[model samples]
Target: DQQVKQNSPSLSVQEGRISILNCDYTNSMFDYFLWYKKYPAEGPTFLISISSIKDKNEDGRFTVFLNKSAKHLSLHIVPSQPGDSAVYFCAASVHAGGTSYGKLTFGQGTILTVHP
Candidate 1:
């Protein structure tokens, strides 16, 4: 079974609008949640992240919400622009701490299309 999943394959939003992408995971040990955005022919770039200790984290037009109890997380982008169109991937990892690099489990990417 997949540890993380994105039920919505794609979402479309008008320019200067709001876009919401949802993700779910089954691993309770995951302590860190992150979102990465990728465009065609490029590697994913880190967008934002939130720790399990916190319920939410925001940066500029991007916000990430984590519901630990529900094992779910969502990314919200406000005033979405056409340039924001890309594939968003939700990832979680159990930060083992102490210089140990734990594996990151990623959900299937959600494609977001921002039409101008």
Candidate 2:
């Protein structure tokens, strides 16, 4: 069963616009997180992440906020560009027993298209 899910299958936006990607998780045990972006033939790479202890994490133009009570999270990309067009995935991991396991569960992914 998929513990995380990206409800939006696709999103389109013009260049310089803000792109918002949303995700939700069913497992309360998930405490770690990541957002992976994949372009064309390249492998997925880490985009942004938020720790369970914090509600928001921002890096440059990308920001991710976690709502622990709601079991939801969202990624915000400001000034979307054509180069930003790609597949974005929401991922999460569980931290337990005083150890942080690197195992991650990923969502189905949402295709974002940024038109010039």
Candidate 3:
């Protein structure tokens, strides 16, 4: 079973528009959530994260909202740019273990296409 899932395989949007990516998880034990952006030939870069204790976290043009009760989370990018055209992966991890050594379970990834 997929612990985490990004239902959309890809999304397309016009430049300067908003881009929304969705994710869902089934494990209630997951306490930490993260979003990573990846470009061709490069490793994924951490975009935003939120703990189970919080509902939302934002950084500049990127914002992540978590709805714990629904087991859902989303990443919103305002004024999406061509540079943002890449794959986005949503990950989840449990922090019950000391040192936060648990591996992050990633979604299938969603490719965002920004047309200029």
Q: RMSD to native for every prediction?
A: 1.7, 1.7, 1.5
- Residue 59, candidate 3: alpha-carbon lDDT: 97
Off by over 4 Å in 3: 98-100
Worst 10 residues of 3 by lDDT: 94-103
Measured with C-alpha atoms, the lDDT of residue 14 in candidate 3 is: 97
Clashing pairs in 1: none
Q: What is the lDDT of residue 70 in candidate 2?
A: 96
Q: Write the per-residue lDDT of candidate 3 for residues 1-116, one digit (tens) a residue.
A: 99999999999999999999999999998999999999999999999999999999999999999999999999999989999999999999997777657889999999999999
lDDT over C-alpha atoms for residue 44 of model 2: 93
Pairs clashing within candidate 3: none
Instruction: Provide the clashing-pair count of each candidate structure.
Output: 0, 0, 0
The top-ranked prediction according to lDDT is 3
Give the alpha carbon lDDT tens digit for every residue of 1-116 in model 1: 99999999999999998999999999888899999999999999999999999999999999999998999999999989999999999999989975437778899899999999
Compute the lDDT of residue 69 as modeled in candidate 2. 97
Give candidate 1 misplaced runs (Cα > 4 Å): 97-100
